[model samples]
Target chain A: MILTVTPNAALDVTWTVDRLVPRASHRVDQVRERAGGKGINVSRVLASLGHATAVTGLAGGPTGRLIRADLRAAGLRDELVPVSGDSRRTLTVVSREDGDATVLNPAGPRIGPAEWDAFTAHYARLARGADVVVLSGSLPPGLGPGTYAELVRTAAAAGARTVVDTSGPPLLAALDARPDVVKPNAAELAAVTGHDDAHRAAAELRERGAGAVVASLGPDGLLAHTPDGVWRAVPPRPLSGNPTGAGDACVAALAAGLAAGAPWHRTLCEAVALSAAAVVAPVAGDVDASVHRRFRTTVTLVPLEEPDAPHVH
Target chain B: MILTVTPNAALDVTWTVDRLVPRASHRVDQVRERAGGKGINVSRVLASLGHATAVTGLAGGPTGRLIRADLRAAGLRDELVPVSGDSRRTLTVVSREDGDATVLNPAGPRIGPAEWDAFTAHYARLARGADVVVLSGSLPPGLGPGTYAELVRTAAAAGARTVVDTSGPPLLAALDARPDVVKPNAAELAAVTGHDDAHRAAAELRERGAGAVVASLGPDGLLAHTPDGVWRAVPPRPLSGNPTGAGDACVAALAAGLAAGAPWHRTLCEAVALSAAAVVAPVAGDVDASVHRRFRTTVTLVPLEEPDAPHVH
Candidate 1:
């Protein structure tokens, strides 16, 4: 079973409009809502893939109740800690004319010291039987950058493999805890290591104690630096739909592969195929199974020779 | 005591930002939420003014729960009927740079036929002790234009005064029910009557069986055509801050006056003064007591003779 933590969960609402005009009233044609956050997205994909995934995080107020109900209705196991403040909502305006997505995200509710303690206590108990633990998304206000670092250490202490997917100071801070895998998109990798090259940045992150580094390069595909070898995987062709959940799908594949003790190169192939499939689906954390099947055999994984990498530090 | 009915109640959310740019992400500086709708706003003001106001409407799901919780926290009386669908949310983006408010209003949840019957049953029970019943805001989907008309007839049958504040077909339909009062802002009056002249349009509405017509003329203040007489009330000067709740405040005053059996001219003056004070406050249904007191004495109410109306229908 995989345990996923989303400290700053959101009730994601998507409004479909014919066109988006600033400062003008829009008559939304359709509205779609789901429980969402990085770790929640990861758990949703894992659950859909027939994996037993339990979600634990902080939720509160009406929005929190809605999130919990959605989880239960979807038959995904969850143990969300209650907090005082209302959970945040993330709004996405999907233009029906051009299919462009404009997102408005709230910073989410603040977590008090007591609430943080409560979450950690609950997390400790839930982490006990988890095969792998994934900590994802932004930290709600009041939690320090080291919050994920501490959680990663706790999971590691319990002999569980850990994957961290976050950016900025929190991502930088969590690297010191030596998570089994750290997934950073190209932009996030550049922002953190001050290196425009994915290989160089991944190497730097690995030096800071990441066991393996997977860098998502959007349309360019997936690049991974593991203890066994460095590999790159790309889809047969670029598939276009909505790229919102592609990266999380990649993380889902990586987590699933680690749990199954799959070979690193095979894991890279699965991650690339799953992410490409996700881009063809409308919502995040969802993949077209048929597309995944086609891409699984079509995606190519090529191992990189260490001496040929000029950007490697 | 005043009873306010809001079938399309909403969870109103306000997000404050430095500036608003279309298609660009914004970091909201502040967020405020409250239960809101025209009747709800009227009830809120009536409660603040020490009037006993009981609210009855259709509420359901998580958003409805939050609205009820907020009303309870504010010490307002409510008996909202439950439905299967969730209540809607209305968002207001207040740009602090120029204090401009951009509003996004949803059509609200669809009220099934069963839900509508459930609401009418609850409303009839609550209307028994009410001095006045105010039907306000838009009708949700699945409710006909005659919903307010039916409610007005029910309230009148219960020996309670009826006030309808809405526009278009619904307003036109309810006037035939001979509601004690009907209030429409200038735009709504123009839309329904095709007349830009407030007095003429209001007189026409009164002729159509509305016992009284109170037309809000924006900065021009309030104009009324009633069985007692014709009256116009204006503040000493144009007071502006946030005009979101000014009309609701006017409705609050009208409900209060009808419950007290005050003179029509005095009711017009009070409505104008309260509305002016409401405009100077940040949130709807809230008034600066000192501002209200000053405006109450200074707002000029003059009787308009029937012959002085050049555009009389």
Candidate 2:
């Protein structure tokens, strides 16, 4: 089973208003809440794809209880360690008029040293049974930048392929553990490697010991630099809706592909198709089933000899 | 002791952002949450003033748990009845630059018949020991408009002085139950009695069997129509800040006064002063202690000769 870890999980609340007027009271038209964090999103996508997946993370207080209840209701396997601080909430205000979403994210509950030790110990046991381990999202406060690095090393020692999706210092630090895959969006890639070009940034991550790099290019699709070859995959047409969890869906595809020992080209195609389908879904961490099925046949993947080139057809 | 009942309680969450731009993501600078509802707000203020207060209401789910935990942490006596539906949340987004707040209030958890029965039974038991009972805020779904009337009647039967703070039909109906005092803001007064004049509206309410009518005139302070006499109280000068909970603070003062058997004029004076102090405070249900003390000495109260006559300063 694939194991996903989200250190900073949250209770995501979505409020819909007729029109968002600054500094005015709004009679919310609707409210929707869900369990959310990068790894939790990834695990949800994998479970939808019929993949056996389990999620591990730190949770606490009432918000944490709500998250746990949601996970249970969704039938997603979870092993969340308790913390002293209350978990945070992420608010997304959706404008009913234009469907534009505004997000407000707060830093999550702090994880103490003792909590960190407990998490690491629990993860080591889970990692041994995990076929593929995916570490995603920001590190909660009280933990140093090397937290993901230590987790990656632990997974590696357990002989499980690891995929880490994060940004900046934590992503850079985790590279030394030689995770099987690292997924970064165009902006995150530039932020870490100081390269505006996705190809060069992926190459930089690879040089720092990432087994492969799958860089997401938003609506443009996925670009990969794997051991077998370099590949670029694009959807047949641009899909429009909420793009909040599209990248997480792509990571889920990549992790599933790696676990199933699928060929790189087929994996890239699946990642591109699923992410495109995800864009049309109403909320994050979910996809329209019919859209996903249709995109599978329409997405195009082109194998490239060199990384620094782009071809769209 | 004062007994406050909030049929529709909520976990109030506040987020502070640099600016509020519709359809744009906001990086929240800070977050603050508290247990809130109109009656709960009154109870909080009473607790701050060293008054013995107990809050009873219906709560369920994780949000309810958070509210209970906050009340416990604050050392407020509570007797919250459990329900099946989850209690709701109210979001207030405060703009850091302008200090303006935008609120989103959802209808709270639906209370089943069983839950409603359970709550009223618990309230009756508590009302026996209460000197003053407050029925405040909106009624959740699964209850009729006459819910507040029933509660007011119950408190009256127990010989507890009753204060009903609500609007529209609920307030109009509770007046028939002969509550000791009914606090309605200027707009609510106009809506119920079809009188633009606060004095006329308050007199109309007293004519309908209400023992007293304490009409909150916003920045102009309060206009009271009691058997003893008519009195109008205003601050020395208009205080400007957040006015969201000023009315609730006024209710707290009125409740405290009734519990202590204070004279009507003194009660109106305290209500006006405390409410003005609440206007300058950043949050609802709280007052600046120094501001409260200053206003206590500066607020001016006038004994009105007639109900329809206008008085400004």
Candidate 3:
């Protein structure tokens, strides 16, 4: 079984309005809701791909119960740790006139130390029964920044492979634990490695103790950095769909690649292909059957040695 | 007992954003939920005022359950008639820049004829025990236009003073039923009366067979006409607080006034005072005790006949 953790979970709400002006009212034509969190998205894709995934996180109030019910209805397994405050609800108002979306995301409930201890202990025990563990999303309120790294350390001791996908301070902390793999977007990699160039970004991220680095380059494709060198995996085309959970597809692909025992070269190629397939699909993180099968054929893999002067990311 | 009927209640979700634009994702600074509907607001106020009030409405799905749970938590007596579809959620986005609010109200769950029949029977029985009955709000989807009017007829037949607060065609339907009273805003009054002038509007609404017509004139207070004569109940001050449910506050005052056996002269004055108090209160339908008490004394009840048509809303 694969385990996924989302420190802060949310009921994501989106509305489509004609236009949004300051201090003005807009009639929203459409509204949509989904059980949301980076780890939840990844686990959903994993389930759709025929993998058994167990999700654990903090949830509370009526909104928390709703979120847990949604996850169960979607056929995803969960162990929700209830808290006192309501889980956050994020709003995305899409303006049709301007072709842009304004997002209003509530900061999730503040989790106290006792709650953190409960989750950490429960997750560590749960990890003992899992082959792989995924520590995803931002740190919930009241928890220390090094929370992910501690979880990785605990899971590693339990003989489970850990994969970390996050950004900023949390990602920086997770690097010290040397998770088997770290998947960061181009921007996230740049922020962490302090490199504008993708080639150097991958190299610097790998040097920060990530056993391997898989940098998602949006339309360009994927960059992989290992002990041997660097490799670029190019997809057939750019994904064009609602850009909400595509990154989770990359994370799912990376986990699946690791599970398949493929070589780094082959794994990175499959990750890029799957991510591209998800982007072109209607819903975020959705991989069409035909595209998934066809993408396996066209993904291009190019390998290179680590440069003598490791490029500054 | 003041029984308030909210046929299609909502879980009102309010979000505060810097600005609103269509098709754009906005970062909501704050998100909160409360049970809402015209009659629901009136019931909340009545409950606050220490009046015995029972709210009946359709509620379903997880959201519907939350609505009932919240109403109970707020110490409001409610008995929901469960239905098939999910209860609706109303999203009110407050953008600070323009001081305007955009409302995305869900077309609430479709109400089948069976639900309607069940509610009417349930409500008619409840009405026999009530001193006043308020049938409020617009028609939800799958409901016929004259639903409120039918509810009004049922309440009146049960010997309860019936008050209808709705607009457009539904308002027209209730008028033909000759409800005890109809509270229409200036615009709704104009639509019902076929006249833009406040006095003419009141006459037209009264001609439609309502026992009394109270045409709200916003900051100017109310233009009221009863069997006795026309009168104006003027507010002591024009307040700046949000007036989302001020009209409902007036209707609630009307019910409480009628229950207290106040004559039209005093009922109209009390309604004006409650509305002005609502305007001055920070939250919707919240009539400040001090403000409400103070305004009760300042509301001028000027008889239309004695004034000689000089001026007054």
* Best DockQ among the predictions, by candidate number: 2
Which model, 1 or 3, shows the larger DockQ? 3
**Top-TM-score structure, candidate number:** 2
lDDT, model 3, position A73: 88
DockQ of 3: 0.41
Indicate whether candidate 1 or candidate 3 has the larger TM-score.
1
Across residues A182-227, which tens digit of lDDT does each residue of candidate 3 receive? Answer: 8888888888778777677776767778888888888778888865
lDDT by residue (B96-161, candidate 3, tens digit) is: 787567677667778888987887778888999999998888667888877877888888888899
Highest lDDT: give the candidate number. Answer: 2
TM-score of chain B of each: 0.97, 0.96, 0.94
Inter-residue clash pairs, candidate 2: none
The positional error of residue B37 in candidate 2, measured at the CA in angstroms, is: 1.3
The residue ranges of model 2 lying beyond 4 angstroms of the native Cα positions read A303-313, B305-313
Which one wins by DockQ: 1 or 2?
Answer: 2
Off by over 4 Å in 3: A14-32, A79-85, A94-101, A193-201, A302-313, B18-29, B96-100, B190-198, B300-313
- Candidate 2, A118-235: lDDT as tens digits: 9999999999999999999988788888888999999989989999999889999999999999999999999999978777778788999999999998888888999888877889
Chain A TM-score across all models, in listed order: 0.97, 0.96, 0.93
Question: Compared to the true structure, candidate 2 yields what TM-score?
Answer: 0.93
lDDT of 1 by residue, A1-313 (tens): 9999999988999887777676666666687899998888888889889998999999998789888988898888978899998898888877789887767777889999999999988999888889899999888888999999999999988888999999999999999999999999999999999978778788899999999999998887888989989878888997766666898899899999989999988888889889988888889878889988988888888788653456454
Instruction: Report lDDT (Cα) of residue B287, candidate 3.
Output: 76
